[model samples]
Target chain A: MSAMNKQILLKSRPNGEPTAANFDLVETPVPTPGAGQFLVKVIYMSLDPYMRGRMGAEKSYAATADLGAPMVGGGVGVVEESNNDQFKVGDYVMCGTGWQSYCLSDGTGVMKLDPKQAPISTGVGVLGMPGLTAYYGLLEIGKPKAGETVVVAAASGAVGSVVGQIAKIKGCRAVGIAGSPDKCAFVVEELGFDVCLNYKDADFPEQLAKACPDGIDVYFENVGGKVFEAVLPLFNDDARMPLCGLISQYNMTELPKGTNMLPALMRAMLTHRILIQGFIISYHFNHLPAFLKDVSGWIKSGQLKYREDIVEGIENAPEAFMGLLKGKNFGKLLVRVADDPTRN
Target chain B: MSAMNKQILLKSRPNGEPTAANFDLVETPVPTPGAGQFLVKVIYMSLDPYMRGRMGAEKSYAATADLGAPMVGGGVGVVEESNNDQFKVGDYVMCGTGWQSYCLSDGTGVMKLDPKQAPISTGVGVLGMPGLTAYYGLLEIGKPKAGETVVVAAASGAVGSVVGQIAKIKGCRAVGIAGSPDKCAFVVEELGFDVCLNYKDADFPEQLAKACPDGIDVYFENVGGKVFEAVLPLFNDDARMPLCGLISQYNMTELPKGTNMLPALMRAMLTHRILIQGFIISYHFNHLPAFLKDVSGWIKSGQLKYREDIVEGIENAPEAFMGLLKGKNFGKLLVRVADDPTRN
Candidate 1:
């Protein structure tokens, strides 16, 4: 009755733009469930930009993932063995299972999923962290008002898509900046964004400025560097910037060479009276109930749409993650570790 | 009897730091009070850093001073003759009189000053714009808490001095940054700041870091550039910055040669979740009554102290103003256009 578990471990710390060499695929014994615990056979693993931050030793909102240990992440799984009364065998659950085919978890911080409600894999994507992140980061920090311009980067991805849709719902002009033409198309056409600029375009900055004629009111800052430089001069007085992530600069080994930008940025912030606040989504979980209620209704009513780029098998997690970092993946990126019984 | 009225006119806009050549002292016949108007003999001309912004044709919180016109500023004056019932001859008042020895007002924005209160010149400095600037910028925006560290630049000048004293009153450690050892001494010894660092010192950044043991919670940004660079790294999470002015960059012809500082500043703003906002004091005039009551009480109770650096005679204004920009003047820089009867 014994089975081997497939796991992806952090083989080495990345210098810049993490490659497959930084991760190792290893076989380990299936974890046994003790009292008040359960063994999960992970079905889906979420691949996110923040994982890059966790791989580094630098202090971030989340602690660094230890080397040669299972790379930290959240996953949706089926409870195969359980001693806890709250989670039974065959129960669908979402927990911090890292990048593994099977993981041991206590009932703490794990949420049970209902099969009839929606697709269970969504427990890690639009219905979970990314969704909540877009919700609070935009509504709470950006405070987008009717007719205001709301700009978000990584437009076709999980959080950015939701942010643009929500901005539309709030009566704002949702402008998106994505890495490719396809991503831009998906954002503007499918996600109902007013305009989506391709950051890869040589005229991206000019196009961005032309798109935001009244100037940007609420900027959801996910990508930093060039995208930010374009957005800076176009900021209207009293613009609010919700700085959720700096994905563009995550792989930068050293600061880019230039005149120090800190003074000019301060001058802009002062002149425009911009409110730039960086935040971790987990800290503001109190907005979860409201987010779920509103977003669920939107999805059910066809007002909100989501796309998933799911890769098959646990062994491909590292490659998929690298793709995710390079803006190669479209929509909410995930690794399908095992069969989702609820899906089919 | 005919008296010639002297006025300082803007000769031409300077490319960088303004020179005496930019100002022209011209004489014109003084006008008599018309219907509903009063004649003011300007006594104290307040020279502030924000005047630098008005000289340029760029859009700001206030309108640009017209070329070939008298330079715009606030002044404390005596109502020499009045046709308006609200004002009378020999009464001291404060109004936006520009840089002139005589001005005619309709009593629209003029405020009657009681000689019995503080000195009438303070109507432009401590009890006026600078006082209000410090009060609102610190209390409303910075929101310094007990035991928190508050840092302000231009420590011995009008606004910074008040900001430091107010931070002290709120039970926070007040650190001042100034250009010279003498200015630093006045800030620490006379204004009761906990410590004052001279930005002119070679080890200024190190000294500033050492001074802020708990890291900076509140930074009152009056002099931007190197002082801001020193403060940026020392900011704690959730630090609040009230960016009231950037006196250092006011005279710069172009941005200093170096790495573009905007990205780095944005990162700091995001990482620290800092709230940096620029404001002009006149916009927040709703706080005037409360400001007057509290500040006057502090001055009377010895909880606050004020020092005036008055340049005698109208002819010395342009040179005095240039000195004011270079951190040459101590305390609030005021040009005495006429005898202050209240002072004697």
Candidate 2:
């Protein structure tokens, strides 16, 4: 291991869309573990749209990330040294190591990863935060019943992909909306979605309506904006909407210009008896055990499939994240910080 | 008995706010009851805000009122003639007699009304549709917890008044919003709400915020224009919203001008993990038995108080309904079409 640790710190908040200048890559001395603490060599760092909210000074569901400090995130890491009995050297673990190459933790919220069970990178990917987000948001909030039509936006991305797959497993007609035709094809073919439509199509609304002939019963809201507008009129009576994220609006600086259509939206919701709820996965930690068991079984039986969009080097996280906001990444966006021993 | 049956027919659909010209007073030859059918002499008719939605040609949760047909509503009447084994002369019953002097029914949805139990008018007021709407919307959807602040709009109207009273029953701090000072006073003093703010006041939002020192935990949305704007910023984490009606926007012909603030609204709902669900009371008929028992008990113990805005004569129903849209009625609006034998 190197004596220097590379860290990406939030230099400033962005007014609208973020740029690389907002983040500063710095090198510091490798952190040492203290009593009951452990040092982790971060191997894979996750770059999610949620990190953009944390970078701002405004109070969100989660606390804001302090400027000039390492950006907050989760990662899969190798335990280099441990002062705690629960973790040992050479063991892999999932930790909130943020956007850093090396970090020190006191074992709180740290879960040891078993490499023999699944891939180590999955601790921060399909079998981790994104997977659990899809599990709870789709099952608990959306509650897709058998043979019901379930629609999800950002269909080829991390969370939406899992949501659609789970909907299918629950005997639903899973439909997906993606940015590109190729991604749509991948979602329908590889992910086993009933249908996948490219939201960028000129006839997106018509296409979405045609895809959901019986109307949408469960709408997994991931990317709001034009995509949401397409799904609104197709909602069936008693539809359930699990509002997970609005990635399309995350980078918006101000309220968009146009008529205040909230009245119309509320009317549609009321007329259909739709249940729209926003949820954060961290608030539902009690669901994690069931999520892990079911998802692991699905993966083992080849009932679940996942794709990763890996960007090598911690220094490239900002660019990769900016691409993620623009739908530039193909699947789950991640920053590879170090070489994986189990891979070779 | 009169040889003619008087009816209020829908003359035409209104563009924005309905006018008296939209209704026509018509008389038809009285028809005799068939076998297994009974004739009901309508006495007291209920006029609710939801009736406005039915007037429109557009499809809402309920079916639209047919053109040139008697306006749809609920009423209590005396069975003047009966050929059915279940009903006899002089028996009071609740039926969907609409806006008419007489209606014939075979008891599909008709319920026998005992004048000895409670006022027959209550079949549509505090002990009937409006009361059950409050009970189910507040308890089932709003889920108000003790010490939590619950805010209800159109505070002095049929649904809102009951919602505020029930919130008090559940040990929640109930804040109400009405259109005038008198209505606000009634909501606080008569309805037993913790506080009531007049939305017509210049500093309405400030007053609302002051009333709810603790952020709003549940918002029973009845009026949905300016009142909703004020409540949006005061929502606490895990807030629940029972979206019953948008009475304020029911008369709107077009979407309001200005910034499309849905993004901001979605952001608030997401940050708070708010659950906003729209529901129709008729869909929850199973709750009626419990609702009747609890509300009857409350009325007997003086824990529940009710006020009725009674307008005499069926000819005045059009003007009274228009007044209701403008928040002119003091309490539950009712049209005493004929003599209420149970009253004296």
Instruction: State which candidate has the highest DockQ.
Output: 2
* Model 1 ranges with Cα > 4 A deviation: none
Q: Write the per-residue lDDT of candidate 2 for residues B200-289, one digit (tens) a residue.
A: 888999998899888999999988888899999999999999998998989999999898878878898888999999999889989999
Predicted candidate 2 versus true structure: per-residue lDDT over A247-266, tens digit per residue: 99988988898888688789
Instruction: Give i-RMS (Å) per prediction.
Output: 2.3, 0.9
TM-score of chain B of 2: 0.98
How far residue A310's Cα lies from its native spot in candidate 2, in Å, is 0.7
- Per model, kept true contacts as a fraction are 0.53, 0.82
Best by lDDT: 2
- Cα lDDT for residue B145, model 1? 97
lDDT of 2 at A2: 65
Candidate 2 colliding pairs: none
Question: What's each prediction's clash count?
Answer: 12, 0
TM-score of chain A of 2: 0.98
Candidate 1 lDDT over residue span A1-344, tens digit each: 67789999999999998988999999989989988889999999999998998998875667899999999999999999999888999999989999999999888889888878779988888898999999999999899999999999998999999999999999999999998888888898888999999988899999999999999999998888888888888999889888888888788777666666565666777667777777888778889889889998899999999999999998898888988888999999999999888876
Q: List model 1 lDDT by residue over B309-329, tens digit each.
A: 999988899999999889999
